[model samples]
Target chain A: MELLGYLGEGFATSLMPINILIVMIGVTAGLFIGAMPGLGSVNGVAIVLPITFIVPPSSAIILLCAIYYGAMYGGAISSILLGIPGASTAVATTFDGRPMAQQGKAGLALIAAAAASFVGGTISVVLFTLFAVPLADVALAFGPAEEFALVLLAFTTFVGLGGDDVLKTIIMICLGLVLSAVGLDLISGDPRLIFFDQPGFYSGISFLVLAIGIYGVGEILYTIETQKSAPQVTPAKITFRELWYGLKEINKLWKTMSFGSFLGFFVGMLPAAGATPAALMSYGIAKLLSKKPETFGKGAIEGVAAPETANNAASTGSLLPMLTLGIPGSPTTALLLGGMVMWGLVPGPMLFIEQPDFVWGLISSLYTANLFAVLVNLALIPLFVWALRMPFTVLCSLVFVLCLVGGFAPSQKLHDVWLIVGFGVVGYVLRKADYPMAPLVLALVLGPLMERSFRQTLIAEQGNMMAFVERPISGTFMAIAALFFVLPMLKHVKRLLRRDLSPAE
Target chain B: MITGARGKLRACLGGKVETIMLTADRVLAAGIMVLSVYFMWHASALPIGWNGMTGGPGGGAFPFWLSGIMFLCAGGIVLRSFKDSAPFAKDDTPFFDPDTLRSVVVVTLALTATVAALPFAGAYIAIPMFLLWYLKIYGKHGWVLTGALTICTPVFLFFFFEVTLKILLPKGWTEPWFFPLYARFF
Candidate 1:
């Protein structure tokens, strides 16, 4: 009953015209940015963050949150239509989506992606509403030790998972962490690496800078270097029957839907666990569990279903930790958190108690936004497909302009323009070298938090690392990290020993 | 295995294109590794301290640690390069065709030069000139499209950042020259 009342109040607040308009604008902008290759949800949110400074906190949060979800929806378009993934999470989608596009079912694949995203997003939002408060209460009980351990877990998992080469991913992550430490220390206020001795440097490398560099600039470089001889596009239109068939295909893959949603929600709840990893992991698990795993590389329907569902669910799931602990789970969430702070609504255990209307309003708006995304995507996929038909030169030029403007809009500084170009070169090199860019990008996002948490833990325990093991919650996290590290080594050893045995064995 | 001079040239430039690209990439990666090590060293040498009351370590501390880790990973990369003698292509196709490389490098350099010049010239001047040149020269767009984009780009930026967001952009010498125009509009 109390929950119902809170929800009612939330609906009332979200119903305001200004809030709805913000959500609509955010969703629209997000879809545009997200659909563009090299512009992820993080970039979309970061690019528009400065506008939030002028708007009310509630409106700003609503806009950013809507954009985050909208971008997730938008990412599927390029994956299905062009075989180019707009975000890392959508890479899995391209496996099946592009093949489906080749079969002239591009519209169907897009619809399926949109519908699955809506379903997954709605389910996660419901889960968030039910569990967010309780999770906050539980998290409130945690001490500095547990928080530190949690951050460590995030760093280790992010650096360890994904990519063909773990070492390269670690290197990229380390580079990101280093880049993040270029400004004044949060706790000590001492300047570091400020060669220019400028106040801009004092604040450190901006998230905007890193995001534009890795995703925006990097993507441009990749496209440039790998210029396809002939633009690989097929003009595919979907009939009503095909749309229905795609819907049926999704309905048939009910297990994929459930598994993706579950995995996405679970991972999303973990701090720093963003949509991309959730999508990738769910796709991997689906492949592992599928009877015909070989169909995965082909355009298997489940391949599209798993990642599409997972990314959406994870987007919603990320909000849980952000709202409850004042800690952003991903870059998009970080932008939203920044908005919340600007609103004077610091996200913590006290958020729900002090600002029930604010919390509920944001929550309710998410439900509406998901519904809006489905409608918008269904209507827009054909138009987006038409956009894919534009001349490559023209399209590339337009994209470059958008990137330049977007990169500069946040600070209105030329330095950011140079930063983006620099990052673009780095990103291009990393991509060429087969280094997973996700880890580096995520590391850049999570770097400062991890450093802060580690230092806080050290201070609390007077530099004694044992504090992490002493507390039950912290111990559990450390145990998980230990298990994560040891299990991989054990598996590698087992594989090596097995290889040593002859075929007769 | 004796080959004619022309055949040898073709094999060196065309037949062995994949090998050259792979070798180049490997060398680049090795260079990056060395650079990362240097960056680590430089980052570590920065002045980092914690204030009183057990304040946390300064910003340089995390970067130093990261640079060190990157250096180690780069070392691993160097080892791998030594182990893999044969050229490894990411895809089956040729890594670089002449036309693709030319187009990519031109655009990249153009974009880089545009960014580099922005600090000196005001955004209003830099953006339009870059857009016009890119559209007309590289893109081969008509004068109408080029002219429209060139004009609209700066106006859109001015309003989006300066008017709406209230963030100040570097006006450069052009600021004093155009102060009346901006002051009137703003």
Candidate 2:
């Protein structure tokens, strides 16, 4: 009853004319940005954060949440039409979606993708509505000790679980944390990293500047190296007859769709697992469950549907930890977390109770956006495919200009624009060298919180190390964090021991 | 023996690429190790807060400890780099080709130039100049198209960002020059 009552209030708030108009604008713009190569939802959302400072907080929520979900839907369009994925999550979609397009089944692929995304997004929101408040209720009881342990768990999970190489990821996370320490110390207000006595250094590096520099300009530089010209793409359109047939196909494919959505949602809850793994895992599962497993790579409609569904579900499902535990499950959520923080809405269990209207209104708006995404994608797939055919050079140049504007808009600071340029070059270099970027962004946002909780706990226990494990909730979280770090090391040690112990060795 | 290792690295990198990439693995590993030391050094100067006392866990405690951990990790990377099994140990390919590197340097300069111009020239003037250079010089599009895009985009940005969002972008030292134009929007 409480859930429904809050949701009803949320719906009323979200359905207001102003909210609806902005939400539409957000999603439509998100779709356009998402469809463009080198500017995914992360860059698009980061670019819009400055503008959110101008809007009412609730309206800002409606706009941003719309962008997040709408970009997930739009990511599939470029993946299906061009071989290039619009977002990292769409990489799985391209494994089958492109082949289907190449076979002249582009219309069918488009409809199936849109339909699966709708179902997956709708399911995740329903599940989120049911479970989010309860999770938040539990999280609200956490003291600083538990919160520190939780942040530790998130960091270790990324280092140990997210990447192929552990050392590289850890180094990246540490570097981000170090950069975060550059600002005026929270408790003492002493500027630490400002070796140069500049006003800008006093406040520290802006995440918006780093984000625009890295994701926006960094991506442009990356693309320009490998590709000199844009690939031509033919627009794919669906007919009424095909739309009717898609309705029946959806019924037949319900099992695969449900399986993908469920698996993806669970993966999304794991810290930093994100949509790529969710989609890949579901695609594998779908192939395993299939009667004709060999048909997977070659142009299976089920292949197209499964990954698309899972990715959309995972994108929404990733929000669970972000909204409830105050930890972002993926990089996109991390940027969203930063945006919320900028609006003076600290994300935590307290968020649900303190701003029920903002929380529930955001949840309600997801439902609205998911439905709108399906309708828009179905109607405008051809337009996006055409947009894909536009000059890549022009798009890169435009993004370059936008990054400049976005970096400067926040405080109208020339130094901030310089930061964008500096970080853009840094991002491109690190990316080329194969350092993971997601953990870095996640760590940057969570850095101050981690430090604060850590100090608070240290103070509470009067500097006793055992107090961390003394509390039940914090103890459990700390134990899990230990396990994530230890398990990998244990595996490596055992392998070395086996090699040494073997007679062949 | 060193030549053989270098040969293997070159094989991984492709023969035509830069020689710096051959030693890139060790360079990057050492680079991070040095960075970690720098952080630890600065953090050591701040109060390593002992309790709720000493100004609440001291300003330096978190960074000092974390940077120490980072130092250990950087050492691990260095150790790993020497092993043949490391990820980029044999990778010798140029990080970016010559043309690409040239573009990167040029674009970076263009951005720096834009920032330099922002205070004196304003967003309206600086942005168009950057676009023209990017499109014509860096991107190599013709005058008719580049001219249209360069002229039109700043005007579009002005309305969407300033007029709609109520966020004033910098008018610059020439703020009074736009007094007549400013009366229309506010």
Global local distance difference test of model 1: 0.74
Using lDDT as the measure, the top candidate is 2
Error of 1 at A31 (Å): 2.6
Q: Write the per-residue lDDT of candidate 1 for residues A1-505, one digit (tens) a residue.
A: 7777888899999988888888888887788777876567877776566556667888788888898988999898878877888787688899888998787667778878988898789888888989878877888787777766776676566544442466766777677777777776666576666644556666667666666666566666676666564356556566778778888888887787888988898787664456877898889999999988998877788888899999999988878877887666766776666556646788877888888888999999998888888878777766776666655566566556666767776666666777778777777766776776655655665566678777888776776768789889989989887775565567778987988884864
Chain B TM-score for all candidates, comma-separated: 0.71, 0.77
Q: Give the DockQ (2 decimals) of all models.
A: 0.42, 0.51
Model 2 DockQ, alpha carbons vs. true complex: 0.51
Query: For this target, which candidate reaches the highest TM-score against the unseen true structure?
Result: 2
The alpha-carbon deviation from the true structure for residue A480 of candidate 1, after best TM-score superposition, in angstroms, is 1.2
Ten-residue region with minimum lDDT total, candidate 2 chain A: A226-235
Predicted structure 2: lDDT: 0.81
